[model samples]
Target: MRMDWTALPEAVTKEVANRIDGSRVLPATAGDHAEIAATVAGARGKVFVKAARTELGVRSLRYELRVSEAVSGSHSPAVEWHFEAAGWLVVAFEHCEGPHADLSPGSTDLGLLAATLQDLGGTPAPDARLFVPSERFGFAHPAMDGDRLVHTDLTAANLIVTTQGLRIVDWAMATEAAPWVELAALVAWLIGAGHTPEQAEQWLAQHSAWHEVDPAVLTFFALRNAEKWALKSRQGSAGWMHDLADWTGQWAAYRRRPAN
Candidate 1:
């Protein structure tokens, strides 16, 4: 149900055009998502627009908008304007320009990402009923319960390498959980980026948030992550999904091994 920006209903386009003070809408090439996205060029400047036309899109975009509004700053985009009419919800953001993070083992972008994660961890989790990672993983451990605002999806694609620094976007899957949760997820991503499981943990461990987590809890989390990804990988999805699942599975196995 993805609609091009130019093809969007007249009402939705009109609203966006008014907000950006633009006379025309130039739709960006679609990504793998269920929403209409584009950049509108106006007299003032250009602003990015993402709109949801379906019920699922509405719910997802609403959550994304909420998180964007909650954590307003350079790290996250601010919602310039938002409106819902004719069964469509739209929000405009200050366009962040840059390529996705280069997560290769020795890439400098990793340093920037470290800084970004540190800042995000310090940001208080919004006072909303966000999904808890512990519940999603069915972990009975108490360590998983805390009020840290975690991006959850820490893949390279989610981190944009902008001039200021690395910025985490795609808040649609954000959740409230332990401060160390994101670090744990990054461990898997790092492995996917060609770092050994041990090296990944070593790199993320430099962050203070990772220090706050206990060893036993981390072990449990690794086990659960391996289980989740392993199941998904078995479903026969090709490419990154399967590759990431393998990477996470490797990290879990590494955790299970006896320390020298």
Candidate 2:
């Protein structure tokens, strides 16, 4: 996924410049995603450009663009435009400068994450209903859905710690789901980020959305996510993926069999 700005086709570079009205482009190799990524600078403006030329890359770009278009919030970076240029799928986002969020236990950013999620949970889901988590993952306990949009991929890499506050980036996994559902879904990532099952629960308890969730609903999501992670672990992933699957299972186990 790492690629230099100069590596892009000249046609793409030209279109990118046209999009931002920029003449100078500097490569920004910060993210794990984006094939032709850089900071386009010139008289018109400075913006972050992300693009990909592969079929899957184009498809993924469209998904993210649509999802990004669905929400407008302080938690999200403002996107300038999304379009195809010289056979490359591309999008330009307002250039935001900050380090990725630190979600490790006890970090101040964790509170900021809570605030951001709270704000995001309040936003209604996009009207098009492009995807439905209920239909996707049929929890044995039945679906608990509402109009709220959910960002399923809330990894540290996707979060930015800005002077204003915590902002979430990357909406490729956005889907229609209950806000409380997202609260429940966040537990595994919390565990993966070094929160003990107990600590994660304590943190989740502070959120009003989690308070409204029925115990069975929480159990259903935990069990379902556990199963999903279990399968993902078997797919030959290493390191964090492997550890995530294990941590998620352990957290589910704790939830299933509470301490005496």
Candidate 3:
């Protein structure tokens, strides 16, 4: 079931109208269960609007607001400010300008993203109870150290290349977890995208300080993610399922090879 924005309570819409000075609104990008776009008032400048109604989503938005406030002075791009009113979480951010599709992985822009992640990891937010234990440890591993906050959903859609560099947009799934685990997940994503294990390892080693963790962990996470993608593909597109099957066969063959 999808959320219908028009069904939102009247009180929420009025609150949003009051926060931003203008009534003019434009349709923006839409995510799994939310719609995001830019808003403007009469000469007051622009702000971001994110509206959703799912219970989990509301929790995530509230947490993101806290994290954004906590890291405001740190200069990290992962953080953004959001407010809750009229049953919607309307967020105001610096109107950043950039075309979204052009920012791809492995491009020079990724360097800035890497730096942002590094800074976010380095900032210790021990008191932030934004992420529950189960949600934080559920994805990659069974046991998480719970040391740092991680932007768990780091997909291409969530990354925006702005004038300042790169900024991560979605914060609903961000949670506190072991830093290495999140890094491992990123490495896994790189490997699944066709990078050799060695190449992925080298890339992570150069990118983050917590690169000494077992490489086997990264491979495990990658395989897990691959299986999930394959299952989803089987449901959505036959061609994707076929490609995933072929990739799985190649992965098995590579796994059987002796270490050099």
Query: Tens-digit lDDT track for model 3 on 1-260?
Result: 33444665777666656666555655455455354444444345455665655677666556666666555423334333455665576665554456552323466755765777777676565465667435543444644456676776555556667776677665666677667655655553454466665565566676554564554555555466556656667677555355554554344334345551
Per-candidate local distance difference test: 0.78, 0.76, 0.56
Give the per-residue lDDT digits (tens) of candidate 2, residues 45-108.
Answer: 8887788888877777777777777678788778898777578888988777788788788898
Candidates 1 and 3 compared: the better one by TM-score is 1
| lDDT per residue as tens, model 1, 25-94 | 6666534454788777888787778888778888888988887888755678677778997888888877
Top candidate on TM-score is 1
Candidate 1 clashes: the total is 0
Worst 10 contiguous positions by lDDT, candidate 1? 25-34
- Stretches of model 3 off by over 4 angstroms after superposition: 1-10, 33-42, 73-94, 101-106, 132-146, 188-199, 208-210, 231-260
Best by lDDT: 1
Model 1 spans > 4 angstroms off: 1-3, 23-34, 135-140, 236-238
Cα miss at 177, model 2 (Å)? 0.6
TM-score winner between 2 and 3, please give it. 2
